[model samples]
Target chain A: MLIIHTALHGEARALINHFSLKRQHDMNAFACFRADNIFLIESGIGKTNTASAIGWACGMLNVSSPVMLNIGMAGHTACSIGECYIANRIEDHATQHRYYPPQLVDTPLGSDCLLTLDRPTENYPEKCMVDMEASAFMQAAIRFTTIELCQSIKVISDNTLKPAGRMKDSEVESLLAPHTEAVTGLASDLGQYRAELMDNTGATFSQLTQQWHFTKYQQQQLARLLQRHQALQPDEELIDTIPAWIDSGKAFMRWLDGHLNNLPVRL
Target chain B: MFSTIYVEEAVCDHPRTRKILQHFRGRTVIECRHYGELLNLKAQNFRLQKKQPALILAEKQGKKILPAPAGYHIGARHNYYFSHMLNCIYDCRYCFLQGMYQSACSVLFVNYEDFIHHIRQQALSHHDEAVHFFSGYDGDSLALEPLSLFAETFINDLRNISNIWLELRTKSTQVRSLLALEPWPQCIVAFSFTPEDISKALEHGVPAIQQRLNAIDKLQQRGWPIGLRLDPLIDIEDFEQQYRGLLQQLFSVINIDNIHSISFGAFRMPENFYNRMTGLYPKERLFAFNMERHDGIVSYGESREQDMRNTMREMLLEYVRPSILFPCVA
Candidate 1:
């Protein structure tokens, strides 16, 4: 799953059109657009709204882990307009707190530092891309997923030669339009990693629980045992081989333990 | 060949850090207030990072030297160990670093002067007794020697210290720096070995057994005392024949009188580390074996461990004296 967070609709317009996302009328707190395995949230402006929207989306989707990307326009000190970059470092200007997002996967766009402030500022003091919600988005997104799954990409909208007040809504859409492929390309690449992680850790409890009723604690134990069994003996199938004499969950647990322990340890 | 380099703001301008940055001039250089900001984050996938690890340069702020782990000494009254670097260049399936650290990126502590000062201070305090200092506890000492210059700098400085002994433990053949200098008599270039088949199965990115043996032969001919470290003796089919072949190959290259110390131990890991490693690589055959846990340490049960140790000990006794043989029980 991929979740895209943007501060304004103008920034999310190109992605929504590219992914053919439909607006979720029931989502009242924030404007959300959804497609298969992909979600986009227009989390108004500022830090609080961005954070609240991310928490709400993760809860609403009920996903354990999802690839999150915060894409929007940011003011840079000296970068050219329409230039896109993935943020490697993000800092909150008010509190001086910082976050470093690991750049492990391969991406086409280059990377740079990002500074998140409370309000839009025309005076750029640091040589970084200035935004209003990146730090908050990153902090909140990591709470629900791994750091590697959370990333922020910035498209330069204004620089020293180009002031922030001069950019119109159409210009904002144009700035983000050319970079939609880059955003979706990165999301697709990260999806492969998420899939690999899930492949090894998928639950195999449903197959065993069909016949035997188990307590919550016993269910957890069964999951771990099945995981170990699958890891050690990937080629062997044990679910259908249960003996008829093992009638109860307690008895089944004991029998499974004995069977696993009896398996030969071939080096 | 790192694609990205993370530099701590404290050491961004350090001479050593600058020299390293010069080597990767075109790479993406990111600055941070601290190295842990990137390397110590939670939920990092060591397997993924191992695919393409970044370089982190930082200073060693806390205690530069520490007492070696219990039973990790080689016949010395005082044993100390320090890691000038964290994480190894090699990715062995049984490496504890996968569980010990959250990230697989190699962290090079560029501040060598402070570590040297503390090492010298500790050794001088025990001037009358033999003080053994071990490198490669948290990483392979010489794997990054060409870039780190760690062994080169320390060897040149401590060569004259008579009572101090330094051991460089590694499975790497990057010994050119050591070869250029006249051998340091008190320093032991300890080479770790597993059987060729076992190494091919578990140890990734490690030099082949014959290549490492050739490097050891060169160092031995240069008058450098060699140490044989067969720690973490893996269990496999026909274990006796495989281990006997490895030992015979090693002794063929080593001179008996020049052998500084011979040590061997069965595969063992702390319980937490074992659990974490199994979680990381669930399908790994090495972790699939039904092992036993005793006193918070996981191993091949008491009887299997004892049997493997006894077999290796009997074979090692053929070439080296019993006085210099050490059994790492930890």
Candidate 2:
């Protein structure tokens, strides 16, 4: 699954309309949309809210290896308004100022540190840039997916010294419109990368399971056991199932042991 | 819970060591020459070691006890805490030790006598005042009591000191030693608890909530002073209801008169520690909270934190007196 979280409603609205038919659910704060091969989430403002929304979205969708993109507007310290930069690091300015290190997006748009503050960086300093929700969204989303799938793209809506609140809703939309095509193209590329990666990993697991050399009946039994393991909710039910699976496996191994012993003398 | 004994050569041949080493069979003995060299070494991953951590038995050289963290004490004039051991047996996913330590190995400073002597000196310094000495700050107090004999030795040593108050904070249900001892008025056997659902989800290797409560009831009946710590309160969907239910269930069975203190704190961690922990378990659902880093502390955002604290405080106040309540700010 692919998710795109945005800070402002207008920016998300443009992408949502552009990818309208691909949209899955509009749960007010976060809108879930599909863009060709990717699933997207337009997460609302601020680090804390965005983190919670992303977690909820992951849980609701049950997407294990999702490609998460925080597509939003940010105030840049060095750049002018209306310019776009793909972030290499997402820094939580309020907390220990730790940075989420760079990942797969090797774009010349350059690396900008996104400061996710509890409140908007109203008194934006020359050295510090401000964003509403990228850090928290990235932190939470990264847990559900691998490092390669986690990406953030921010368009500069204001200069460092200026407040992010001053940027009009329409102005934010206009700044992001031109990059809408670029963002969609990037999303499609990411989805293909993720699909290929999944297929490769799945193929490896399949090969390993096949090399174990179980009969058809044994394979069916193993599949049934794994399904039961996944389906059970209560701790006791799951714990109880483990022993049965283990006992069955052991019993099969014992039978195989006798059969192998009887035929091995020919060697 | 452990079957092997890892010893530093400096204290391996000590007189008291022979008795402790004889207990475990199929023991693999590895010798290290120094404690300081191994204990503080970097590149040893704390998270991975937790899976099957070894126990390190070493002697503590100096400064056995230290002052507690700021805003950590409650209802005491001089607050101090000492760890006879480092690293917990239970692997709670949210524990800071996983991020703080270079290794997950449990370092048990076998010099229990030295720790007691220092604690005694601190208590005597404040003769008339109620001096509180907390144990299990770095690790659970009674989790490995069977092997370490920590609670047994400390209980005996503390009996001589009249003014000193000891708080043995633990999440372990291994209260065999505690139940056997005649209860001391100055000693508070505290149990840290959370909602059952949360415990099951995150508190791996810890005894169930029901089991802990049963142990508490047994200890209380034996006349031991009990304390309840609901620290690092997790943010769940129906958090208020969950906490309320926990408080009600505890109060229903526990004797309120014997309750020493009830404390609660919102989930918070140092930024670096949180970062390390996140790196260790990149796919953990618990780290995916709506958290904010404010003034070097990472926690749930302000409004949500305040709401949780106020609501939990109100619920706790309903059953316990205000004087017995403590809010852990650190």
Q: Of the candidates shown, which would achieve the greatest TM-score relative to the real structure?
A: 1
Off by over 4 Å in 1: A166-169, A199-203
| Candidate 1 docking class | medium
Error of 1 at B225 (Å): 1.7
Clash count, one per candidate: 0, 5
Top lDDT hit: 1
Every model's DockQ, to 2 decimals? 0.51, 0.01
* Global lDDT of model 2: 0.72
- Candidate 2, residues A1-267: lDDT per residue as tens digits? 677777666777667777773656556556666765455665666776688778887888786566778888877666777777666445676773433332333344545556666776556645445777777876787678654466778888776455466667677788888788777776676666566434222342354255456567766544433332222221333323232333345454444334322321110
Per-residue lDDT of model 2, residues B1-330, tens digit only: 553356777778875566667776655444544454444555334554454466778898879999998888768878999999888999998898887876677788888899988998898999778899999899999998887788888988887788899999999998999888888888999999988888888899999988899999999999999999999898887788788889888888898998998888888999999988865664455764435889888988778777888898899889878898888777
State each model's C-alpha RMSD to the native: 1.9, 22.2
Which lDDT values do the candidates have, in the order given?
0.87, 0.72
